[model samples]
Target chain A: MTGSILEIRDLRVAFTGAAKPVRAVDGVDLALVPGEVVALLGESGSGKSVTLRSILRLHPENKTRIEGSIVAAGIDVMALSGAALADFRGKTVSMIFQEPMLALDPVYTLGAQITEAIRKHESGVSADAARKRALGLFERVRIPSPERRLDSYPHELSGGMRQRAMIALALACNPKVLLADEPTTALDATVQVQILLLLRELQRELDLAMIFVTHDIGVGVEVADRIAVMYAGRIVEIGAVRDVIRAPRHPYTIGLLSTRAQGGRLSGKRLPTITGSPPDLASLPPGCAFAPRCSSATSACLEAAPAAVELGHGHAVRCIHTAAVA
Target chain B: MIFYASKRILFTLPIMLGVTIVCFALVHLAPGDPLVSVLPPDASQVIKEQMMALYGFDRPYHEQFLRWLWRALQGDIGTSIRTGRPVSTEISKAVGNTLMLAALATAIGFLLGTLFGFVAGYFRDTWVDKAASALSVFGVSVPHYWLGMVLVIIFAATLGWLPPTGAGPGGSEDWKWNWVHVQYLILPAVTMSVIPMGIIARTVRALVAEILSQEFVVGLRAKGLSELGVFGHVVKNAAPTALAVMGIQLGYLLGGSILIETVFAWPGTGLLLNDAIFQRDLPLLQGTILVLAMFFVVLNLVVDVMQTILDPRIQRA
Candidate 1:
C-alpha cells in the first residue's frame, strides 16, 4: 500500500510495420510515488512520449506490441480488459497532451466534454453533479471566468486557455496518476511557466503521481522532483533533479546539459551538440544505442549493452564507463 | 446568423438567373424547328409561319428571353409545347415524384454509407475494412442504368417479385403513396442510391480515419472513454465532412435521376426531361432544367449553413 502509485516494469513497445518493427520503447522501467513528479527528459526521437503512452496502453492495439506490467493505484493495468480498462483510465490515470487545440474536441463546449468524462467513469453521478464537479475543476485549474468559459468551444479559447481547459478536463476525475506528454511544449514561454507552476501546485494539492514528458531540460528542472533522461528508447540516466543537473553520469545527459547552457547566457559561443543523430530504432547498433554519439565510447561500450549501475540515494546510470567519463 | 443566411440567399439569386438564361438559349439554339414538329410535314408555309409566330419563335432571341423572364417573374413559366398545359403544373407534379425518389435514395445512401465507413475506419486494414472499401469502389464504378437493368432482371424478370417500371399501376395516380407505388420505386431508388452511397462511404472512411488518428483522439482515450465513446467522438468530429459530401451527392442524385427514371419508367422529373428533349419541347425543358439547377444551388446553400452550424470554425469564416 505504501509502494509507488505508478510502477512500470521492463516496458518495451514495438510498432509493427511493413518492413521491420520499430522499437519505440525498449526495456524501460520507471516508478512514481504519490505526490511526486518525474520528468521523462529526451530529445524528439528519444521515446519519452511513447513510454508515457505505454503506461495507459494508448497506442493502436493491432499495430503496437506492448510487453510490460503497468500497475497504477494498486490496479493491474496490464491485466485490465474492456470496461475495466476504460474505468482504470481517467479515474485511476489521466493524461494531457502537447496541443490543447488538437486535444479538445472542436465541436463540443468545454463544459460538456468535462462533465461527460466525469459522468462516464462514475456511473451513478447525475448530470448536475457532474457539471458542478466540472466547474470546480475549471476553477481549480485557475481558468478565468470558468462559468462562461465552459460554454465556449475549443477554438474560442486562446492557446494557453485551451491548455488550461485540457488540464481541467484531465483533472475532472481526480486521478491518482497524471501522464502529461509535453503539455506545455506548444504554449508561449510565459504561459508555459504559468502552466508549469499551476501543474506543480495542483499536483501537490491533490498529491497526484505525475509523469511529465518533455524535451526541454529547463522545463524539466522547473517541475520535476526526479528526472529520467532517455536516449534511443532507453533510460540513460535517472536521479534526483538536482543530482542529474549538477553532475550527469550519462554522456547523453551531459550533452543535453551542455546544449541547454549554450542556448542560455552564452549566446555567442558555438553550441556543443551530440556528435551524431540518434540511431534508427529499426536498425539500432549493438551494445549501447548511444555509442556512435558518445564521446567516451570504448571497445567494451561498443561490445555489449551496459548494465544499470546503482548509485546511492536512488541514482542510477546505464553506462559502462560512468566512472571514467565522470 | 440571419445576415449570413441573407448573404447566401443573395449569392444564389444571380446564379439561378444565369442558369435560366443559359437553359433558355440552349433549348432555343438546338437544331429543331418547333413549327415543323408541331405542324404537319406538308403543311403550307403560311401555316408553319403562323405556328412559329404563335410560339414567339419568330421573334428576336433577346425579345423572347425578356418575354420569358417577365412571365417567370410573374410566377408563370409558360405552357409546355408538348402538353399545351401550364409548365408550372407539370413541374409541380414532377417535383413531387423526384423529391420522393431523391429523399428515399439519399436517406438510404447516407445511412448505409456512413455505417460502412465507420466500420472501415474503425477497423482499418482489417478484412472488414478491405471488403467494405472494395464494395464501395464497385458501387461507384457501376452505371445507374446498367445497375437498374440488373436489378430488374433479378427482381422483376427472373424472380417476379416486383414490378419492373412505372410509379404505380394505371388508375393509381391518386394513391401514389400506397404499397404498390413503393414496390415500383425500390429498383430505381436502389440503382440511384448506389453511386452516392459509394462516394459517401469512401469520403467518410477517409475523414474518420484521419480524425481518429488525431492527437485529441489519443487524449480522449487516455481519459478512459471506452472504445465506443471514442468512436462516437470520431463520428461527431467527422460528421460535418460527411454531411458536406452527402449534400453534394444529393445534388448528383437529383441530376442522375433523369437516366434512372427513364430506365425504370418512374414518373419523376428525370423521365419528364427525357421526353421533353426528344420532343424538343423548349418550355418544358427550360422550366425543368431551371428548377433542377435552382434545387442544386439551394441544396448547396443549406449544406454550407449546416456545416457552419456543425463546425463554428466555418461560421467565423
Candidate 2:
C-alpha cells in the first residue's frame, strides 16, 4: 500500500437514520494502486456497494456516521468539508452507477450533464469548450452518431447506448480512479457484455484504477485483476482473480463458487446452495458471520471473529478453517 | 411543441361540447318556469305561450340546444334577470375582476408554497419541514370563507385600516390597480391564496422529496455539483408537476370563489353566480358556468403543454 493512489483504513459506515443504527460497512481496509482493477464480489447486503459508495463519501451527511480515515491522491478524504469535498469528487475520482436511466437526470440532455460536470471541475472552461470535450468522450466511448446522441435525453437512447452515454459522462473530467457499482446489472444480457468490454477498454486507455462491485463471477473474471469476496461487511477473501476463484481459501467463497453451474451446461441435478441465509448486518454475531451457513464450521469458529490471515503472493483469507476449505 | 399544444387544444373541444350540454340540461332539469320572473303574474296562459315561443323555449330540445349553443358561441348570452344588463357584459366585468384577483393570489401562493416546499424537502424531517407542513395543513384544513371573515374582522373591521367590501374606491364597478382599490383586494386575495398555497406546498413537497430520493441526485452530487446546483436540478424536475398543480388551482379559484366573494362582497363571478343562484337568473348562471368550465379546459391544456415542455419523459405522440 506504500505507493497506492487511494488508501482506506478501518472504514466503518453506519446509518444512524434507522431506529437501530445499521452498520452497513464495518472494519473495511482496502488500497488501490493506479491502473489496478479490483472487483468487490458479493450478493445483496454484503457491503460491496456500501464500501464503494463510502470511498466517495456518498452517504447522507446528517443521517450517516462514517468512522475511519480515507486518503486519495495525497488528500485526506474524510477531513474534506463543503467546498473541499466538492472539489475532491469528480476531479479526483468519479462513479458509474448500476442503472443508467435512473442515474442520469431525466430533464437534462446527456450533452448538458457531461458539459456541466466538465465546467464544474475546470473553472475556466466555457460551455462550448466543455461540450466539445463531451463530444470527444462520446466518440471515445464508441457511441454512434456521437454528435446527435449527445443532445438526446437518457430515455431516448437504447440500453447499451445509455450505458455508453453514462460511461462518457463518468470520464468527462478524467479522474484517476473510477468506481463502477454494478454498471451492467440493469442492462440486457447481450448489452451487458458490450458495456463491460467498453468499460474495460476505457479503464485501460485512460490508465484509471477502477473498483467494480458485482455479484457475477463471470464479470469479475472478464474485467477484474483482483477479486475481493465480501461476507456480511467484511472481505473474507482477497487475492489475484485467478488465485481466489481457482484456489478459494474461505468456506463462504467455496460455497458461492459451488452454487454456480460450472461450464454453462446444466447437470440436471440441483445446483448446490449454501444451507442458510446471510446474517443480518444490524445485529451480527461476535464470531464469523458465515459460520451459521458454513458446512465446515467448528465450535471454535463460534468463539470469535477470525482476522484476515495473509497467504503467499498477495492472497489472504479470514476463516478459522481455511485449511478445511482447501 | 406547437403540434402538441394544438393537439391538446383540439382535445378540449369534446370537453367544451360536454360543458355546453350540461349548461343546456340545467334549464330543463330545474323545476320552474323559464319566463316566470319576466312575465306578468296575472297574465293569461296565452301570454305564457307567447313568452315561451318568443324565447324559443317552445322549440324541440335539439332545436333549443342548437339555438342556445349558437348564441353562446356568438357571445350573445342573453339578459340577466337580476340586473337587466346583458349577461355577457356582467360576466365580462366580473371575469376581469376575478382574473385580476386570481392572478395576484396565485402568484403569492405559488411563490410562498415553492419556497416552503423546497426548504422542507431539502431539509426533510427537520423542524423547518415540520413548521412548513403544519402551516400548509392549517391552510388546507381551515375553511377559506371563515378565514376571509376573520381577516376582515382584524384588518378591516377592528383596525379600520382597509375596506371590508367592494371592488374599488368610490364603491364603483371599475377596478383600478391603485392602492385604494388594491387595499380592498388584500383580505380576499390572501383568503383565496391559502387554498392553493396549502395544496401546492404539499404537492411540491412530495415532488421534491421524490426527486431528491432518485439516484440522479446522488449522481449529481457525485459529479461535484454544489448543493445550489443540485437544488437547481430539483427545482427543474419538480417544476412541471408543481406548475400543473398551480394551474389547476387557479381554475378552481375561478368558480370556487363563491364563498370567499360572498364573505367579502367583491364583484367577481363568484358573487355573480351567488346572485344568479338566488334570483334564479338562468341566463347569468348558464353564462358564468360555461365561462368557468371553459377556463378549466383551457387551463388544463396550458398545463399539459407546460409539463411537456419541462419534462421530456412525457412526450406526446
Candidate 3:
C-alpha cells in the first residue's frame, strides 16, 4: 500500500495433468507503482498472459497449482476466498481481454451488464444510479449516441466500440490495478493505436497502475512506461521502455527488437526472426530456457540459467554474456 | 418483429396445404373401401353401391379431394363415415383432453429435465452428474409405451392405487380439472413424459456445458458476480437453445400423446385416430392428421418467435 499498488513475488503457476506439469509462469516477480503502465512483451507461449491472470487467481483451481504471493491494494489476493475474493476482483483489480466480442455477454444489453457489475460490488447503489453511472462511462469512452448505445447488445457495436465498452466495464468499479491482456491485439492497426492512446490517457488521468500485455514491441514502445520481455515463462529483460528498446541486452529481447518494422537495422531486409522455436515448458532444458534459441549461447549459458544482473538506470538483463553481447 | 411473425405465418400455409394433400392422398390410397368397412359383410352389392354414392366415394379422387378441401376451408371437415357425426365436433371433444395431458407432461418434463441438467452441467465429472446422466440415458432408451405399461402395472395393477385406463369414471365429464381427474392423468402423462424429459435433460446439459465454456462466461465471473449470479447469466444466455429444444419436444409430446392416450383408453385424439384407422374412416383420419400437422407448424412458429425474443442476436439475424 505504501510503495507499490500491486506487488507479485516469486509467483509460480504450474498446470498439473496426467502427463507432466507445465510451468506456465515460473517464479515471476513484478511490482507496479501508482500510475505506472508496464507492458509485458512476449510471444504466444511466453507466459505473459498467465502471469497477468495469476494476479486475479483466474486459472482453474483444481488443475493449477499456484505458489507465492499476490498483494494488490493492501489485500492478500492469493489468500482471499468467496465474498472476499469476489470483492478483490473488480474492486481491487479488473481485467480487460483481447477479444471484446467474446468478452461481452451476447444476450444482455451493454447497460444491463455494466450496471449489474456496479450493483454487485456496491450493494447500496440503486439500479437507476448504476445505470446513470453506466451512461457516464459510455460517454467517457466516447461511444456515439451513448444513451441509445446503452440499450444495444454487444453484437450491435463495432469492434472498436465493443473494446471501448469492455474497458468502460473494467473501469466501472474503479480498481487500482488494471490488467489488460493484449487488449488491442484484435483491433485494426488504426483502431489499435487509438485504443492504446485512449488507455494511456485514461491511465494517466485516473492514476491507475496497469499491466499491458502484448507481443508487439511497437505497442510496448507506444503505451508502456517500462517493458518486461518474457521468454519461455521467465522475464528475460526488464527496463524503462526507451532504455530496453534502445539497447536490448538479452538475446531474445534483441531478436524481438530486430523483427520490428520501424527503425531497426534489418528494416528493409528480410525480418530477423529468432533462429529457433521457443522451449516447451513441460520439458525445458536444465540451463536458461532460452539457451537453445539464443544465438549467443555458450557452454556456461548451457550449464546453468543466468541470474538477473542490474544495469544502470534500473535496467536488468538475465543472460551470462550480456556484456559480450552488448 | 411483426414482419417476421407474419412471414412465418405466411410460410406455414403452404406447408399446411401440402400436409393436407398428403394426408388426403394417403388415406385414399390405403387398401380398403370405406363402404365395405361401413356396411355389413353380408350386405348386397346394391347396398354397397348406394352407400358409396351417398358418401360421394364413387367420384374420381381429385373431385373428392377438391370437395373435401372446399368443405374444409368453410370450417367444416364433413361427417365421419363410420359415426355419421361431424368430424369437427368429434375432434373438438377429443382435443381438450389431449391438450391437458400434453401440457401437464411437458411442464413436468421441462422442469425436471432442466433441474437435473443444471445440476449435472454445473457439477460435471462428479457423482451427481453421473447419476443424472445415467437416468437420462435410461429414460432415452426406454420406449414410452412400454414405460407407460410398466407404470400402469406397478402403480395401478399391482398396487391398485388408481384407475388403469379410460381418462376417469365419467369420461369427458370426469376430466374437469379436478383432483379426481388428475389421478387418472398420472399414469399416461408420466408415460408420455419419459422420453421428452430425457431428451430435454441431455440437450440442456450439453448446451449448459457449452455455454459455461464460452469466453463471455469467464468475463462474467471476472465481473465479480457471485456463483449464483454467474449461473443466472448462463441460464439467460442458454435459454434460446433450451426453448428451441423444448419446442421440438413439445411437438414430439403432442404426437406421443396419441399413443399414450390410446394405451390408457383416455378418449383423446389418439384414441379417436386409432379407432378411425381400425374402422377405415377416411374423413376422420384425414381430419385428425391435418389438425396434428397444423399444430406442429404453429408450435414451431411460436418457438421461433420465443427464441427471437430471448436472443437479440437472433432478432437481428
Candidate 4:
C-alpha cells in the first residue's frame, strides 16, 4: 500500500430505508497507487457505482450506513466532517459522473462551476485567477474555443463537450485521485473512444489514481491498467487488465468476457449471455452470489460466499473453483 | 438574454389582442342591459333613441367595438354612466390600489411558501414536511373571503386592534406608504395571501423535490460545496418555475379579488367591478375588465422573460 493515493479496506455500504437494509457494497477492498487506472468492471447493480460513490461519501447520510476505512492522500475519508470533508472533495479526490447532461448544473455556466470549485477549495485564490485556471483546464481538456464554451450553459454544449467540461470541473482543484462513474457510457460510440483517450492522457499527465467504473470490457481495455470484476456487491476478481481478460478465473468474469463477439469465429453467431440475473441485494441467498447463474457451481460454492484466493503477480480470485472457468 | 426577452415580449402582443377581444365579447354577452340603470322605464322611443345615440349604442356591434377600441387607444375609456367621472381615471385609481395590495400579498406568500417548501422538500419524509404540507393545504382549501371575515372578527371586530374595512381613515381609498395606510392593507392582504401561499408552497415543494433529486444537485455537493451552497443551487433551479406560479397567482389575486374586496370594502377593481355591474355602468365595467386582462398579459410576459434569464434551458425553448 506504499505510495497508494487511495485505499478502501473492507468497505461496506448499505441503504437503510427499506424493510431490510440493502447491502449495496459489501466487503470491498481496493487500493489505487499513484498513476494507476483501475476499471471496476460490472453490470448494473453490481456495486461498482456504489463503491465509487462511497469514496466521496456521496450517498445521502440519513439513508446510507458506511463502515470500514477509506483513506485518500493520507486523509481518513470516513472520519472527516464538515469543512474538512468538503475541502477533501474536489481537492484530495474528485469525481466525474456518467451522464454529463445530468451532472452539470443547467443554470450555471461551465466557467462559473469550475471557478466555484477552484475558489471553494482555496479561499485565498482570487476570482480572476480561479477563472483563468478554469479556462486553462477547459483548454487542457481540448474543448473547442475554451473561452466561449466557458460561458455556455450545459444545454448549450454537445454531450462530448459537456463531458469534457465535466472532466475540467473535476480536475479544477488538482485532486490526487479521480473517481469516474461510467464517464463515457452516456456518450456516442465515436466520442466514447476519444474521451477514453483524453482521460487516459490526463491520468498519465496528472499521475491521478483513477477508479474508472464501466460495464463495457472494450472501454476497460482502452484506459484501465487493472480490472476489478464486481458481482452483486463484491469484487470477485482483481488483476492486471490483460491478465483478468485473458485468464479470467471467476465464472462471472468468464461469462462476461464470453458475451463479447471477440472476432471472426463469433461473427454471425448469437452472442452468449450469462444466465439468470444478479442476486437481489436485499435478500441475497447464503452462497456465492454468482452460483445461481454459474455453470461451474458445486454444492461447496453454495455453502458460502468464497474468499479471495491470491495468485501470483497480484491477481486475486474469489472462487471455490477458480480452475473451473480457466 | 436581451434578444430572448425581446422575443418573448413580441409573442405576448398577439395574446394581449386576444385578451381584449375576449374581454369585450364576454362583457357584451352578459344578461343585463348596459343602458337600463340610466334610462327611465317608460321613456318614449324618440328619447330612448337619442340617449342610445349619445352613448354610441345605436351603432352596430362591430362599429361600436371599433369606436371603443379607438377611444380606448386614445386613453379615453369614456365616462362612467353612474359616477359621471371618466372611466380611465376611476380604473387607474382602482388598478393602483389592487396592484399595491396584490404585490404585497404575493411577496408575503412567495417568501413564506418558498421557506416552507424548502423545509418540506429537504426533509421529505419527516415531521417538518408534514407540518408545512398541512399548513399549505389549509391555505389552499380555506375559502379566502371566509378567512377574511374570520380575521376581521378576531383582529378587527373583537380585539379592535385594527380597522375592519376601508383603504384609509374616513373610508378614503388613497394608498400611501405610511403605517396608517399599511394597517388598512393588512386584513385584505393576509386573507388574499393564503391562496398563493398554499399554491406556491405546494408548487415549490414539488419543484424543490424534483430539483434536489436531479443529479446536478449531487454534482454540486460532490464539487465540495457545503449544504448551504447546494441549497443555493437548488433555489436557483427552483426559482423559474416558482416565479411563473407566483406571477399567475398575482394575476388571479388582482382580478379575482372581488369577493375579498367586497368583504373588506377595499376599493380595488373587485369592488369597482361589483359597483359597475350593479349600476349597469358599461364604460366602467369595460375599462376595469380591460385593464385587469392587460395586467395578466403583461405579468405573463414579464414571467416568461424572467424565466428565460433564470433558466438557460428556457431561453432555447
DockQ of each: 0.78, 0.87, 0.80, 0.87
Better of 1 and 4 by DockQ: 4
lDDT of 2 by residue, B19-44 (tens): 99998897679999877877778989
Per-residue lDDT tens digits for candidate 1, residues A1-326, read 25889888889999996489999998998988899999999989889999988888888787898998888888988898789888888889999999999888888889989998999988899989998888898888888999899999999999999999999999988899999999999999999999999999999999998999999899999999999999989999999999999989998898889876644678778777778798999887779999888888878888888889988787899998988888
Residue-level lDDT of model 1, residues B27-115, one tens digit each, is 87788686555677899988888888888889999999999988988889888887899998988888888778888899889998998
RMSD of every candidate to native, in Å, equals: 1.9, 1.3, 1.8, 1.3
Clashes of 2: 0
Give the lDDT of residue B57 in candidate 1. 82
Residue ranges of candidate 3 with Cα displaced over 4 Å: A263-268, B41-46
Task: Quantify all predictions' global Cα lDDT against the true fold.
Answer: 0.87, 0.89, 0.87, 0.91
Docking level for model 2: high
In model 4, the Cα lDDT at residue B136 comes to: 100
Q: How many clashes (backbone atoms < 3 Å, residues ≥3 apart in a chain or on different chains) does model 4 have?
A: 0
Model 1 lDDT, residue B33, Cα = 81
lDDT of 3 by residue, B1-317 (tens): 88888887899889888988998898888887776777889999888888888888899989999898999889888789888999998888887778878888888888888988888998888999999999888888987778888888998999999889977779776456677778898888887777778888988898888888888887887888878888999999879988888888887666546677877988778888888888888888888887778789899999998988899898668
Clashing pairs in model 1? Answer: none
Across residues B42-66, which tens digit of lDDT does each residue of candidate 4 receive? Answer: 8788988888999998888889888
TM-score of chain B of 2: 0.96
